[model samples]
Target chain A: MTIKAINVRNQLRGRIVEILTGPVLSEVDIETAGGIVTSVITTRSVTELNLQVGTEVLALIKATEVSIAKI
Target chain B: MTIKAINVRNQLRGRIVEILTGPVLSEVDIETAGGIVTSVITTRSVTELNLQVGTEVLALIKATEVSIAKI
Candidate 1:
């Protein structure tokens, strides 16, 4: 399925640098221009997306899920 | 309560530029060095945090909740 658009406001494009797979979830790290953006997705998604080291991907973050902290 | 630390991997420090409040949620626009990071958090959090224009904050995103998209 082709995703033409997504509601997620933050989209950081980069290449996969590492993958730490677990029983149910996997941590996929992407190296973007800003920095390394890490994403922990379901193991199923890792397999379904055929994600691997060097694969280009976008780290998507929903605005609703974002938390604000005073600093 | 003071939070010493959080598990969220991504944290962007910025100053609140705008805020659109609603009944339940609010869209907070923050200006950071990278760019403008927008967040839609609960209005209750807005009140509790005393968020307003020019408020300095960190936009936090958990790795577990970040989605990966191939590009």
Candidate 2:
């Protein structure tokens, strides 16, 4: 699938090591060479993507959404 | 700030623990209660956001960009 979002610059490649599915939300853990990139997505997307353990995926992140805090 | 993106469902709150700046892209490490949510963003955004270590920010992730792969 081709994503047209130009701000989607980060494409971290990793494997789906674990998935915690919920009714409204789902937590996916992607193990990369650097570290584990944990993403909380929707259960609907999980079902649509057919994501499971051992699945390889690219965690695309946009800089705009990555808000910074000073805590 | 209000983000117009309705699909931005996941909002992981974390502190900016580390940042690796480059010419174009910058890697930011956010430490959250759940885990570390790493984001690769443009250096410009990082500068605009004035991100620094110990800064607290929300990592907003859109489900669509969180692609899945079966490996």
Candidate 3:
């Protein structure tokens, strides 16, 4: 299904630079303009999305799950 | 308690620009180098962290929770 819109605020657009596959979780690294955005998602999603190196994708991050650190 | 290190990979440093509070969760808009990073964390964390406007903070995001959207 095609998503019209999403509530996630931080959406970094980039290309998949690397994919580190694990038992359950997989790390998909995207090279964005800001920097390399690393995302660890389910291995199942990795396959379902047909993700690969050079595939353009957006790193979607929800507001609620974001933690803050004092610097 | 002071945290020595964390496993989260994405840590965007920025300052709090705006805060929209709610009953349970609060929206924290941080002005980072790339852009405005919005976070919706628990109201308790907001209070416990002593977050306020102009507070310098690092927005931490876990890799596993990041979603991928192909474009």
Candidate 4:
């Protein structure tokens, strides 16, 4: 998916530090240059991404209300 | 901070699930309606937010290249 924003605030990079799997949700921890970021992705996404500890990923965050635009 | 975008794809609301403190950086876990969202903020932000395990916060993410736009 492509995400374009007129105002982008935060985009941080980190690695998967840990992954905690639960019956309903899975917690993915990412260790970045600055710190560690955690994401609760579906067990499906986890399987799709094949995310494991030490995988490099990016965490994109915007400190505003987000709307979708079709390009 | 105000985050605005022409295209916003994902915005999830979650509660603070956990916080891991280190010497320089801190890990923040937010439990949302769908899942958990993790953010790596500075120790300063952690202190400023006064984030605990149960703090409710919004985890805003956009799957795109983000730029800053000033209004």
Highest TM-score: give the candidate number.
3
Model 3 regions lying over 4 Å from their true place: none
**Each candidate's TM vs. the true structure?**
0.85, 0.50, 0.86, 0.41
* Candidate 4 residue runs with Cα over 4 Å from true position: A1-8, A65-71, B1-71
Q: Which tens-of-lDDT digit does each residue in A1-71 have in candidate 4? A: 77566365777788888887755457777888878876666678888888888888887766663455544
Q: Scored by CA lDDT, what does every candidate get?
A: 0.88, 0.72, 0.89, 0.72
**Fnat per candidate:** 0.79, 0.37, 0.77, 0.25
Going through the candidates in order, their DockQ values are: 0.69, 0.23, 0.70, 0.14
| Candidate 1 structure lDDT | 0.88
lDDT tens digits by residue: candidate 3, A13-51: 889999999999999998876677899889999999999
By DockQ thresholds, what CAPRI class is model 2?
incorrect
User: Where is model 1 chain B poorest over a 10-residue stretch in terms of lDDT?
Assistant: B29-38
Please identify which of the two predictions, 2 or 3, would achieve the higher DockQ against the true structure.
Answer: 3
- How many clashes does each candidate structure show, in the order listed? 0, 11, 2, 7
Off by over 4 Å in 1: none
Task: Give the CAPRI rating of model 1.
Answer: medium
